[model samples]
Target: MRRLALAAALALSLSPLTAGAASAQTARATASRGLTPAEVGTWITGLGGRVGPVQTENGLTFFTVTNAGLTWAVFFYGCEAGVCGEVQFSAVVPGAGATLDKVNAWNRDNRYLKAFHTAAETPTATVQYDVVVLSGEGVAQLADPLAVWLQLLPKFAGEMGYVAP
Candidate 1:
């Protein structure tokens, strides 16, 4: 009887019915909500990046993400009352040895990630990804973009012959 009770409890814990209801509750609670600039800043800090104070211009919000010798400008999009659906992560390549050729090469080989030079003197490498902001997994989904940024930051720096400080 004890064994049967244990088995029943385990089954209930793993039941799809219970799991679906829990997820549904979570989705409802966060459905209208989206990612926020403050959350991104906190997340960047958690990733060992030095985050500067967040700033807003017009409807866009952004902050600085510094890791080792690399610094990035992270921006949020689709924000309404602090919520956002997407993020753009960018790092400016140092101007001393930067070239548009390298930027073009990166863009040619990469899919979602790219490198470009604006009218600004420094070349910039960037990655942007959309977040699922109206689902139970919305917040967790942010790891997707962050993971890409983490993976690319060092590699891109190396490609540019940058020595991390």
Candidate 2:
């Protein structure tokens, strides 16, 4: 019985799941350096997003990425003279079946993201992250959020009864 238990423990420790966990830890440790607006744009483009021209207004840098049939704006906050302190990802929800309840439910269930409805009957979902201008989590921190957003885009479309382009 002890030998069987020992063998089971060894198999579990050598599993691919354990390797994936280790890899995730390593990625987190290495992605401490944050990104600039331009760098963020580059990363989005690299992720197969259709990126629009970048614009700077006031202290924010803004750009749009069209992916999974949704066009979303990526805003870099506190950007002045080309540096940023935070980033926000937002998408305008289609007005057909989008409701305040859906937004509220999303906000209540989600931990790192939020949804809101505007007076103009537009629903928007956003995810924001604060980062140190120079030495914070860089593209690595953004990769998962972007990926998750992409996955949710289809679900949001379905919930709002909007057809994906």
Per-candidate alpha-carbon RMSD to the true structure: 9.2, 11.5
Candidate 1 overall Cα lDDT vs. reference?
0.70
> Candidate 2, clashing residue pairs?
32-136
Count of clashing residue pairs in every prediction? 0, 1
- The prediction achieving the highest TM-score against the true structure is 1
All candidates' TM-scores?
0.68, 0.65
The lDDT of model 2 is 0.70
For each candidate, the alpha-carbon lDDT, in order, equals: 0.70, 0.70
TM-score of 2: 0.65
- What lDDT tens digits, residue by residue, belong to model 2 across residues 1-165? 999999999998889888998999899656544467788899889978999989877756789888867788888875544656667777676665677777677667766556666545465433343333445656677767677667766676566556765
Clashing residue pairs for model 1 = none
Residue 136 displacement (Å), model 2: 5.6
